[model samples]
Target: MKENENKNEIVEIDDVDREIINLFNEDGRMSYRKIAKLLNVSIGTVHNRMEKLTKNGVIQKFTPVIDHSKLGYNLTTIIGVRVKGGVLENWEDRTAYHKNVLCMYDVTGEFDAILVARFKDTSELDQFIKSLLREPDVQRTYTQTVLNIVKEDLSSSKML
Candidate 1:
């Protein structure tokens, strides 16, 4: 059983559930029939398990793994930001909806939050950093450009 942090619910996942998840992680478009065949189970079992997994919040949503560079988002950056006292959440809420922000975290260190964002070019990145600086609560920001991506997999199913 795994605990869902968001819902505070215990999700019971058996070996079959793990296998189904692994197959979907490899290919999200895989059909229930195919998964059933591969796992040597009935198609109904696959459907029921998927439904239970989704209902339990074990499977959030199926999405494609995109290569941002192929889509002209040529620059990837990791930025650490320091916010004014008591306004970290406010700043996070304001910034979370930005199209360029891929992921954000409330972290422990010198910085209050960290953001991973992608930009089309340096000009866009410059504009974004300047915009953050313009915010009253944003005390400072440190940006680092990524030169190469060794590996990027945003799937937890691999760990299972």
Candidate 2:
């Protein structure tokens, strides 16, 4: 791993680090001993690499991939938000922690920000949209209901 003067340092990884990440992606709870055996390295090496990866922000967190649909959140929507000038960051800060928001992005398009969110049903979605409109900085919104999700993988290990 390489260090930088700034907090957001860009860390470099080698083949061993890639393998360790790939194994963890396969099973977040996999034992370090198992990873060491698979990679033909000592358990200490795996532990050290993982510690470095986490410290460098490569591994943000170990979490399960949930099936929201199974939990009654079957409705998914992509919303394009148009915010009043100079308040997009404020709006994002407020909305980012909302329970329904899966991910948010600032993109190059007609809209200021895009939000991907899930809801239990249309009523919940309606209320959520109305709440957004009630915000002072929100000018308008265009929402698209997702009929099908062909691919949704939130794993960074695949990029390795």
Candidate 3:
């Protein structure tokens, strides 16, 4: 059994569940009938397993991996933030909801949090960073613009 930190409960995924998850990770558009045929199980079985996995919160949502650069969000930058201690969570909750923020992480070392965000250009990024710094809880920030993305794989099952 594995603990779900968000739910604060025990959740166990069996071998079949792992296999189904791997298949979905490979191709989110894979149908239950195809999965059943591949696994030599009934379509009903595949459906039930997937339903269970979703209900148990193992599967959050099925979404596509998009290329942000192609969508005119060409500026990808990593912003490291230093926040006032004891208010790290509060500050993270505030910064994470910005539309340009693609991902945020509570990290270690010199920064308390890291934000991966996308913008159309440098001016937009500058405005966003300035707004973040204006927050009383935010102490400082270091921004590094991405020159090029060599590899970006959001799905974790490619190794499987």
- lDDT tens digits, residue span 1-160, model 3: 5545558666787777888999988899999999888988899989999999888887889999888889899999999999999999888777789999999998889999999999999999999999988999999999999998998887786443
For residues 44-135, write the lDDT of model 2, one tens digit per residue.
99999999999878888889999999999999999999999898999999999999999999977799999999999999999999999999
User: Given candidate 3, what's the lDDT at residue 108?
Assistant: 80
The regions of model 1 sitting more than 4 angstroms off are: 1-6
lDDT of 1 by residue, 1-160 (tens): 4454558666778899999999999899999999999999999999999999997888989888988889999999999999999989988999998999999999999999999999999999999999999999999999999999888887857766
lDDT of each: 0.93, 0.93, 0.89
Q: What is the lDDT of residue 73 in candidate 2?
A: 100
Measured with C-alpha atoms, the lDDT of residue 46 in candidate 1 is 99
Off by over 4 Å in 2: 1-8
- Of the candidates numbered 2 and 3, which has the greater lDDT value? 2
lDDT of 2: 0.93
True lDDT of residue 145, candidate 1: 98
Looking at model 3, report the run of 10 residues with the lowest lDDT sum.
Answer: 1-10
* Candidate 3: regions farther than 4 A off: 1-10
